[model samples]
Target chain A: MARTQGSHSDITGPRIREAALALFARHGYAAVSMRQIAAEVGVQAGALYNYTPDKQSLLFRLMYEHMQDLIAAYADQDQTEDAAEALRQFVGFHIRFHLQRPDEVFIAYMELRNLSSDNFAQIEALRRTYENALEAILRKGQAAGAFDIADTKIATLAVIAMLNGVMTWYRAGGRLSLDEVEQAYWDMVHRSVTA
Target chain B: MARTQGSHSDITGPRIREAALALFARHGYAAVSMRQIAAEVGVQAGALYNYTPDKQSLLFRLMYEHMQDLIAAYADQDQTEDAAEALRQFVGFHIRFHLQRPDEVFIAYMELRNLSSDNFAQIEALRRTYENALEAILRKGQAAGAFDIADTKIATLAVIAMLNGVMTWYRAGGRLSLDEVEQAYWDMVHRSVTA
Candidate 1:
């Protein structure tokens, strides 16, 4: 019975998160409720408590896992010592990774105000960890004389912000193919950072 | 008496907008109500209706006015035919204008999903007008061989997205003065568009 219950939790965990993310993305986090999430997941409110203590925990987990997954996915990519090549890879990777997770990306930016102080700090730390990955590349490139950057930290944020813009208006069947879109941005990012 | 009531509306209209903007920024539009806005404005719920028909109308009016103010302010700036100089002015103007109204900027992006479809279309048209202003600069620069851009529209969006990033993390008296910060971004923007 214990094993069966554990298995159930393992399955229900992702479903709860999926439901919470969708609802939070559609209706702002403040407007979504525990019961609503449970309803979306086809579970009772009590059963949701079994999975997460409350809605905030669920939100934190979704955001935390999104960041964790992002870091891990990027880490799994091949690393190169050449700073320009690495930065190029980053431009492509950042755009592609974020484009695939629209709801998570939306919540990550939109719901930061709703996080508890502690939760916000933890998420911010994770975000910094992800951002540092890019900042380090900018610093390495600057040290190696491959890129001309005013401030590595600002460049890092600017690059990410510019890439994140893709999610706002990009549609698969839009005027430009995804490859064309990515190439255009990569060219601009490359020029922006390099002499 | 009629003139006095008209003056009262002129004063209360702005107060109502101020209260609604603050409330919607703090709480999502879906979660905030006419009654809440009325309380925030220190008026009765029924009195709120006199100022605005409903919560949705208030939201549309706030968003409408923000876009209108943005376009009007940008239009009032010194016009220059030089593409690089014009682009620099834009980078500075976009950052400074948005930084002053954090609430409006936050709501502009975050609350788009909350706008009624008709309201959304009008706001989007206003936004496109603003974007076209930038795109035209890029096109002129490219035509004159002043800028090396892969796609003028894409470059327009990329530059604006990059500049909009300042609103996310800028604070006065931080490591960089506002001038330094703007210079850094302007350098990046200028480089990205020009050879």
Candidate 2:
């Protein structure tokens, strides 16, 4: 079949990434093949090369893009004057962003072992950038006497880990709605750091 | 080379489990093969089958035993009378237990998707049993007015999730000592739910 005239790369790129993310999330990066991914995307095995050079590139692109998206999204949020308010907003934003992309979140966290050393370092840098964003907020709160956290770095990691927990058991139509889920996590997060 | 005559099952069992755990943790369950695992254990692929029926069984047994050991260790802890004391014990116990067995903990949480439906259910039930043990403490705290948690169930998850964070980053010779890590975590955990 000939390539579509309109948005060929645009359409196929996302579909490829979507297929790879789902496949990796389910079968793991090392276990999945380009053939399986191409099949998942309804494309020929050779056709996938147009979008990604190889499977490692696909995995790296997925994780790198996820991290970049997270950092960009966090950066876009309004830096509220009140540290508590900023943290509350962060709590909601993080939970919603991750909840909507369970597959991406899972792959990002679990597939690090599969990343090459260079890719791992790059991903870790991006991750630390995101973590530092939270660390900065905790520092702001601590300076303003809004939070009594002992260690900003540890708090950032702890808070992110706590929020990451939401992805594990939370279902769309579960016992608690997303709003309630965020509220509970926010409360715990807020109190955990605040004096 | 002949097989050693000294307690063959006892000798090979732990080595097989150790090799399997490391392989499964690093490469993930679906990607790691029986041959690779046997190679890691310095045994033939056929000899490896004597200990476990298949790769699926190995994966299931690893996860199953991790959960069992968790439950057993938790049960073995001395019963503290006060809810706050109990929670502190749990925070410390959970963090220390998970940290010491990073490979097991990693496999236990990350490899759930690879388990068969039946095996997944069994693992989930064991995990729930572990979660419920913490939930019970929260309930007791709420009853005794020791904690003012919004939702005991979520609080159980949040606290454990918070403690589980330790395993992700904390190292044996990290910036903070184990005692210091436990103290900081226990403080945050205690205050997160306390009145």
Lowest-lDDT window of 10 residues in candidate 1 chain A? Answer: A1-10
User: Candidate 1 docking category?
Assistant: medium
Give the TM-score of chain A, superposed on the true chain A, for all candidates in the order listed.
0.92, 0.92
Over B1-195, each residue of candidate 1 has an lDDT whose tens digit, in order, gives 112222366677888899889988887677678877777766667777777777888999999999999999999999899988888888889989999999998898889988889999999999999999999989988998999998898888889899989988999889999999999999889888876
> Which pairs clash in the backbone of model 2?
none
TM-score of each: 0.92, 0.94
Summing lDDT over every window of 10 consecutive residues in candidate 2 chain A, give the lowest-scoring window.
A1-10
- After superposing candidate 2 on the true structure, give the runs of residues whose Cα lies further than 4 Å from its correct spot: A1-10, B1-9
Model 1, A8-58: lDDT tens digits are: 777788888898999999887987888888777777778888888877898
Chain B alone, model 2: TM-score?
0.93
Best candidate, TM-score-wise? 2
DockQ of 1: 0.62
What DockQ results do all the predictions give, each relative to the true complex?
0.62, 0.68
